[model samples]
Target: MLYLVGLGLADEKDITLRGLETVKKCSKVYMEAYTSLLSFGLSSTGKSALENLYGKSIIVADREMVEEKADDILSEAQSSDVAFLVVGDSFGATTHTDLVVRAKKLGVDVKVVHNASVMNAIGVCGLQLYRYGETISIPFFTETWRPDSFYEKIRRNRTLGLHTLCLLDIRVKEPSLESLCRGKREYEPPRYMTINTAIEQLLEIEQNRGESAYSEDTTCVGLARVGSEDQVIVAGSMKQLLTIDFGPPLHCLVIVGDVHPVEKEMLEFYTFGKSSNQIS
Candidate 1:
């Protein structure tokens, strides 16, 4: 049996009781690291923390292992129970879904364990989940590759008066372009997009397209280290957020659209200079 377990957000303790039980029983456990992960879950101490709590040692699986070498894991699961752990809910990312499909085709029975993810935990900002439109991911802008494919989606959401959740890019265990050209693999330092950088890139895309989709003064909620005790939630204009510092990794931005009276009132609690709940 193959168990696709969710570790949830935050630290090691976010694992559900069922997920914990499943992990403890599995002969082999793999933690998918390239996607979202618990805060500090990759560091040596963090791994120890999870292993100690789950009562099982976890093998760190990078993007290559999960994508290219998934068969090796499935083959092992064919003989014994194995658990593939994800940071958030098990199926939050499409890659995991693909893995499940392959496991099914390989005759490996699979079970999913659900848990809180950014998709739902984001509601802590007080915005009604039903009011959100299609979520969009913002990739990091490069010198020659500034992709604006997501711009139209954002505009569509704003036109319909729906909130747009912008999931910032996360680069982990990525091969350097120079190294790829050199016919060798060299991983670059991990990068987690900051609210400041995401805002800058969004503004740049708006400038190039000359579309009034969103302005510098557009209200947005900047979130960092979400689902953690020290999570920061600051609501302000994109311009204002660009100035404020949202420390740490796993940051996300929410572009506010037509807001109901209640949402507006709730958002006030995180507004800078108004609410004491501002980021520390």
Candidate 2:
């Protein structure tokens, strides 16, 4: 049996009871490391933390192993119990969906254990989940390849008076262009996009597109280290948010479209000001 388990958002202890059970029962357990991450990330200590809890050795599966060499994992699942762990809900990223598809094609039994992810956790801000439109991801901008495809999605969501969630980019173990040119794979250090960079890139894109999908004065919520004990959430205009520093990695941004009375009230609690700089 192949079990895809969610480790929630914060730490190793965030694994659900059922997920832990599945992990304990599996012969091999692999954590997907490229998507979202827990507080300690995939460091040796973090892996050991999960090991201590589940009492099973954990394997950190990088992008290459999961994407290019998924066959080995799938083949292992064909005969023995295997647990594939993800930081957020199992289905938070589309890559996990593809894994399920491949497993099913191979006639492997699959089970999914769900947990909290950014999609639902953002409700802490009081925005009605039902009022949200299609979520969009903002990738890091390159000088030669500045992509603004998500701008249209945000615009459409705003037009319908629905909120838009902007998932920031996380580049992990990415091969540098120079190494690729030399036909050798040399990975650059992992980088997580801060709310500040996302806003700057958004503004740059808007300048090129000449459209008002969003503006500097547009209201947004910046989240840093979400689900962690030191999680920080600040609500303010894009201009204000860009000036502030949302410490650490694994940040996400929310673009407000039409704020409800309750949402506005909740947002007022974390609104940008002297008090917001302090930890919540």
Best by lDDT: 1
What is the Cα-based lDDT of residue 170 in candidate 1?
90
Off by over 4 Å in 2: 274-280
101 Cα displacement, candidate 2 (Å): 0.9
lDDT of model 2 at position 12: 85
Over the stretch 132-210, how does candidate 2's per-residue lDDT look in tens digits? 9999899998878888888899889989988898999988889999999999999988888999999999998878887
Tens digit per residue, CA lDDT, model 1, 1-280: 8999988888888999999999999999999988875256778998899899977788999878888988999999999999998998988889999999999999999999889999999998988999999999999988988999999999999999999999999999889999999999999898889999999999999999988999999999998888888888999999999888878888999999999999999899999666456533
Candidate 2 pairs with clashing backbones: none
The window of 10 residues in a row where model 1 has the poorest summed lDDT is 271-280
Instruction: Assess each prediction's global lDDT (C-alpha) against the native.
Output: 0.90, 0.87
